[model samples]
Target: MPIYQAPVRDTLFVLNEVLGYERYTNLPGFSDASGDVLEAILAEGARLAENVILPTNRVGDMEGCVRHDDGSVTTPKGFKEAYRQYCEGGWMGLAAPVEHGGQGLPYAVHTAVAEYMVSANLALLMYPGLTQGAIAAILTHGTDEQKTAFVPKMVEGVWTGTMNLTEPHCGTDLGLLRTKAVPNGDGTYKISGQKIFISAGEHDMADNIVHLVLARIEGAPEGVKGISLFIVPKLKLDAAGNPGERNTLSCGSIEEKMGIHGNSTCVMNYDEAEGALLGEPNGGLRAMFTMMNEARLGVGLQGLSQSEVAYQNAVAYAKDRLQGRSLTGVKAPEKKADPIIVHPDIRRSLMTMRAFNEAGRAFTLWTALKSDVAHRSGDDSDRQAADDHMSLMTPIVKGVLTDKGFEHAVMAQQVFGGHGYIEEHGMSQFVRDARIAMIYEGANGIQALDLVGRKLGANGGRAVQAFFKEVGEFCEENRADEKMAPYTKALKKGLNDLQAATMWLMQNGMKNPDNAGAASTDFLHLFGLVALGYMWAQMAKTAQGKLADGANGSTSFYDNKLVTGRYFMERVMPETAAHLARLSSGAETMMALPAEAF
Candidate 1:
């Protein structure tokens, strides 16, 4: 089994020190999220994660989910018990509104707990993870009756939820979706569709599954405009508002996927299942995007979660293994060989992991803070600015985090040599699990196109312009501080590179759209590098302040943070230049070859 200790210390640093979570206590739900309260909650959450859920990770993978003959699925052993505890702890409703039987905490607190849960076991986490998204959708867009009927139980964990999209023929192109919804002469509709790749689609842990489904109405307009959203439950609700009769839906089969074996990724069959209109008819895509955007952020966290765990185990192995003698000479002359940690190449790998993991953690928490403000702040202008920031950064968060996250997993696995390849060491599982994030929740390619084609120009580029202005201000303010010089210099350079790439895209992509498409991926990455660099620079500033204050007993922790930030600035920030160069290369070379040339 692999070890996974939640990075609680680093998490707290980001929450209190880097992001100034305390300043937002005046926000609606953040009043109770005091530092001491959050710290205690995090301690308990870590206990649940590290001690309970993590032990089940390898077992779940080995046993997998079993499908029975009755069109039902049973999760691997221990999942049911774990889920019971998860619900009992009120985790599902931690960030939900108080009127719905929830803690009413800020989303940032939930984000921290989510990081722990995902790091411990991503597959187990999905069951509740998807439920949160469904709950948010209902809370945001559902009718008041729908909220009264569904929100409490889902929050309390009696029933779980799933998002049903993507048929066999369609994935991202929801306009081509084929699911059908026929009117039943009442407010209800009879839905008939087969949805594939539905995570937690069928599971025995929860009493009923609430599926927020997308379907086309019988005489509706064609394409995406025709689609409507429906609340299709696996079991119908009774007069008492509990799960009553079984709905006409079943798990056709479970996917034998490469990873997340613990989660029941099912092919769901809804044979004229009774459902109610969720939002307005022909308004599904707009509603669905609310859930999709929330899911995309959660998926971005999944990237960081996998990286944190993989890096932990890799560091452990690097210290224990004794395969190499250091070039600095016989420091371990008494033994056959020195520990592999002594080697420069191994140090490089470890440092790379450390730098990215910390920077990524900061980036995630920063975005999460923005979410808190966007949703909870009273000022309309403040909310708008935060929302714009989130819209611009969503694709970068989804695309860059997953792409680099998987790469980090592979690099960590390499630290274990041949042992990493074997399942016993558990590194291969990390690699496998991280692989799916890049492909799902809108593939990286689509995310890039979204960043370039839509988000860049959204609100007349107000979001991107806001981002540029913010970074420029930070650099200008901190440039003169002697200790902050290195970080600020690197951040300024990366910011310039990002700005140049944006200009090139705007200039060339106008005449030839393929030019934008060709540069999209590289542009997204360049943007991501600058974002992470900005995080590192901010963290460096925070660490410097702490050291200057001589706060309590913390010398090493603050000092080490400065060192890690320095590593990122000097070693990793330069990748922005490479990405900028690629973005400037345009589409001519890429499109020159004929379609059949391959």
Candidate 2:
């Protein structure tokens, strides 16, 4: 069976050392996450992930989710129990506001723990993951009554939540959605629509489900301008605020998907379900985006989580599986063959996954810190800067991490040879599971377009310009440090490539919109490479500092960190040039073919 061990120590390295998480203690929740407290939380989270959640992964995939004749859904075996334990442990609201029953910790701390949970069993985690997004939406955009009725229960994990936006005909285009809502004489409306591909849509784990539905009101304008968000619960609330009457909504059917079988991806049908408007009328897209943005970040972490678990298993397999004699000589003559890890090609794959996972973790935590700053900072300028960082990086995180996450899973699977393809080894499951992250929460292509078409130019390019300045300053600051030379040099090159790509898009994209469309993905990837390269440079600097300070007898860990960072700088950062080249070539050839040519 495939095994997973959360890299708690590596997470500490990123949090305590690389990101200097303690420096932000002045923030609202950061003060609560003292080093010792953070360590204890991660240790406990790792224990749960390893001891409880990891064991259920293969079983969940094997069992999947089942839908009954009554329009109710059952998650894979052990899921309900696992979820109960999760709630009892107070994990569901690790970072939620204290007024709403959470621990009131920094979002960075929550994100760090979430990585472990996701790596343990993504399918199981989705139940609460979607709920967190819903809680965020209601907290951000919902009215006082809506927040009072929904946020506490969802945060407590008694009531899971989902975002219902897609219909049978509409996925990304909200304007095409046909879901309708009509005033029901009171404040609530009667919602009638069908939404497809809703994860954790109907499940037995929670007492209720709060659905944030998007629909158009009667006599509302056509297209997206008419859309409005609604809070439609599975069970209507009583005057005392408990689930009372059944809502007119049911799971029509569950989707048979490529992976994450343990998650109930349902087709939901609403027959005049009672729902309250979440925000202003005709402002549904704006409100729902609050959930979508959070979900996108969570999905990005999902990519990293899968890659981390897959890498762990692949490394274990490579170390144990004996294949051929070492190229150097008979290193393991007593065993008749050396371990496959002795092979250069196998080492190459393992190193690549390792490099990406470590830097990816840093990248994620960095962004999570920005999120905390954006939401919690008292200064308007600080909030704006942090928000800009979020808007700029979210797409890259969702797009690049997932695209690479799936790539690494496949690579990890390849290390097992044909054994990886079979069901027994469980490598296949990782490959299958990681595939969805690239496609969901606004497909990677759409994420790329968002990065290029919207984010890059927002606020007169303030965010992108700030990012360039920060990275350039880092490179310049470290130019004289010999130990940091390798990482800084490579990162500088990658940053330059990213800057050139941005310039190319600005110069050529407006002249031919297709140029922007064709170049967006590459540009996003180029941005991701530089961003990760920046992570490696920072990590290298920190590791070198620790080593110089004697590393407190943990020299090996710091040494290994430097080595992995060097590998990324040498082998991976160079890919930025390729992305830059492809993007600069732009639209002419890509859009040359006629419509019927294929």
Candidate 3:
């Protein structure tokens, strides 16, 4: 079985020391999340993740979810029980609104707990995770009656939710969607469509599955503008708001996927299923963006979570697996050979994983804080600024984290040599699971396109300008400190690299649109490296302060953090220059090849 400790201490350090989360207590819902309260919440969450969910991971993977002939889906053994425990703990509404039966904590707290659940078992997490996103959508766009009828139950985990957008003919191009919603004379619509690759689509875990689907109403304008959102339930509601009649929907089949077998990815068929319009007529895409953005960030977390677990297992294996003698000397002369960890190459792999994981954790949490500010702040300007910053960082968080996450997972697997290749050891499962994060949630490519194409120009470049100003201010503020100079200097260089790439895009992309397309991915990654570099610099400053305060009796922890931050600054941050170079090269070479040449 695989081991998963939730890194609760590390998370607490980020919360208390690095970000100074207590400072935000004046914000709505955060006053109750003081240090002690946060610690207690995380401790219990960690216990649940390690003791309950971790045990079921391999079992869920091997046995998978079974769909019966009657279209009822049964998850692997112990999954329902674990979910029951989760719901009983009030975890489903950890960060939801208080009026909707939620704890009403800040998004930052929700993000921390979710990282634990995802790290323990991603497939199991998806059931509630998707539900949370759906709640966000309905809360943002649903009617008062809709909110009264649905949000509370979802918040209490009595029902789950899903976002149904994909179809047999379309994935990224919502304009090509063919689903239809014809308005019945009363108020409801008759939805007829087939949605493919719907995660947690047909699970038997909850009493109701509220599918927030996108369909075009009759006589609406063509393309994406015509699309409308709907609330299509698995079971129709009774007069008293209980699940009453069966809806005209069924799971056509569950996909035999390469990974996440524990999750029920279904091909759903809706033959005039009774549906009610959500939001407004021809306003589905706008509302659905709410759920998609939430899921995208969660997907990015999935990448980091998989890397963390894979790295943990790999580190343990490296310390125990005997390979060859060290090149420097026979450190373990008593044995025939030293452990693989003693080798320089293995250290490189481990350091790569460590540096990325630590920085990525901080980066994601930082974004979550922005989410809190966007949603809870009293100042309208502050909320708008935070929202813009979040929009700017979303793609980078989703694109770079997942891209590096998969790469790190493969590197960790390589550390185990042949043993990692076998399924019994569980390293391969991490690799397979990590692979999907890069492809879903708008795919990394589309994320890059959004970053370069839409986000950069949004609000006259307010967010990017603010980002540059923020990082520049940090660099300037710490430049004179002897202990922090290295990180500051390295981050300054990365910022310069990112700025140069931005300037290059601005100069070239206007002349040739393909230049932007060709350079967007590299540009997003370049931006991401600098973003993480900023995170490492902040963490380094925190560690430096702690060390200057005599380490507070935790010398090794602070020392290791400083060393890892330095490693990231010295090694990982330099990669931004290469990405800048590639992006600056533009479409000249990339687009030169003829279609027939390949």
Q: Rank all candidate structures by their lDDT, best first, as comma-separated numbers.
A: 2, 3, 1
Q: Residue 494 of model 2: what lDDT?
A: 95
lDDT (10s digit) by residue, model 2, range 1-598: 8898889999999999999998898899887878898899999999998888888899899999999999988788888888999998999999999998998899898899999999999999999999999999999988788888889988899999999999999899889998899999999999999999999999999999999999999999999999999999999999999999999999999999999999999999999999999999999989988999999999999999999999999999999999998888877878978999999999999999999999999999999999999999998999999999999999999999999999999999999999999998999899999999999899999999999999999989999999999999999998999989999999989998999999999999999999999999999999999999999999999999999999999999999999999999999999999999999998999988899997
lDDT of model 2, residue 195: 98
Kindly list the per-residue Cα lDDT of model 3 for residues 463-558, writing each as its tens digit: 999999999999999888989987999999999999999898889998999999999999999999999989999998998888889988988998
Q: Which residue pairs in candidate 1 have backbone atoms (N, alpha carbon, C) closer than 3 angstroms, thus clashing?
A: none
Worst 10-residue lDDT window, candidate 1: 324-333
Clashing pairs in 2: none
**Candidate 1 regions with alpha-carbon error over 4 angstroms:** none
**RMSD, each candidate, Å?**
0.9, 0.8, 0.8
Taking all chains together, the TM-score of candidate 3 against the true structure is 0.99
How do the predictions measure up, each by TM-score? 0.99, 0.99, 0.99
Ten-residue stretch with the least lDDT total in model 2 = 29-38
Q: For residue 220, what is the lDDT in candidate 2?
A: 94
For candidate 3, the 10 contiguous residues with the lowest summed lDDT are 26-35
lDDT by residue (1-598, candidate 1, tens digit) is 8999988899899889988988998898877878789998888899999998998899888899999999889999999988889899999999999999999998988989998999889999999989999999999889999999999999999999989989999999998999999999989999998999999999999888999999999999999999999999999999888888999999999999999999999999999999999889999998898888999999988998898899999999998899868998976788899889899888888898889889888898899889999998999999999999999988999898898889989999999999999999999999999999998889999999999999999999999999999999999999789899999999999999999998998899998999999999999999998999999999999998999899568899999998988988988999999999887988999999999998
Q: List the residue pairs that clash in candidate 3.
A: none
